[model samples]
Target: MKLSDFELDVLQLFWQHGDCSAKQIHEWVCETKPSAYTTVKTIVDRLEDKGAIKRVGKDGRAFVFQTQISKDDLTPSILPSFVKRFFAGNASSLITHLIDDEKLSDDELEYLENYLAKKKKSKS
Candidate 1:
């Protein structure tokens, strides 16, 4: 499912905290920056509408939420669109940007290399 930046941010919080109310998610989000409670709730509602999250329960008159879709589940679905939009559909350009502009550390590079190697082996 396509999520806006705000929706994705909220999802990350749900993933981290597990099932939680919109108020709890809002509180967590507000730690980083100030935003209206309604705004956060609106994002959460949108997430529900998109089927990215499900109503897990309720707490003190507020609905609790949990993820229906994982970040991994969303990755392949969104990646090609991202490549097209941001990287002009160039895989090499995406890799180059990550390596150069993203300033990935040696450890991260090694990890990604190992991951790529494993994928290549699996394909072969």
Candidate 2:
């Protein structure tokens, strides 16, 4: 499902926190950027409409929500389009840019090497 950046942001919170109310979401969002509670509520409503999240229960007067989709399920669908738009559909270019430009620690680099080795071994 196509989601606006704000919707994705809100959806991520549900994935991370498991279940939350709109007021909690708004407070979390406000930590990084100022957002009106109504704006967050509207995004939450949109997410529910998109089936990305569902009302699970309630916290006081607020409706609580949880993610209907897993991050793993969502990433594959989004990654291809992201790579196409930014890296001209070249997955290798995306990986290369990240390895070259990003500050990956030794442990992270080792993990990537091990993952690549396993991937290559599986293909052969």
Candidate 3:
């Protein structure tokens, strides 16, 4: 199922906090982007409609919800479209962009180098 940015944000909260009520999710979200409680609740409801989350229990009169899907579940589906839109559908361009735009620490660079070497060795 497709999710809007707001829905994705809400889903991420579910992934981070496990099960949570809409009020709790709103509080967390408000730390970064101030939004109304109703607004957060609306996004949560939309996420439920998309089947990305399910109501697992309740807290008082409020429903407690958790993600039905993992972050991994959505990343593969979303990445190709993201690449197509921003990187012209070329993964190498995406890699180059990351390399150029982001700072890679020595350890991070070594890890990536090792990962690439392993990938190359597997292909050979």
Who is ahead in TM-score, 1 or 2? 2
TM-score of each: 0.81, 0.89, 0.89
Could you give candidate 1's per-residue lDDT for residues 30-61 as a string of tens digits?
99989999999999999999999999778889
Q: How many clashes (backbone atoms < 3 Å, residues ≥3 apart in a chain or on different chains) does model 3 have?
A: 0
Model 3, residue 73: C-alpha shift (Å): 1.0
- Candidate 1 global lDDT: 0.91
lDDT of 2 by residue, 49-95 (tens): 99988898988888989888998888988999999999999999999
Clashing pairs in 3: none
Give the Å shift of residue 49 in candidate 3: 1.7
Model 2 clashing-pair count: 0
User: By TM-score, how accurate is candidate 2?
Assistant: 0.89
Worst 10 residues of 3 by lDDT: 1-10
RMSD to truth, every model: 2.4, 1.5, 1.5
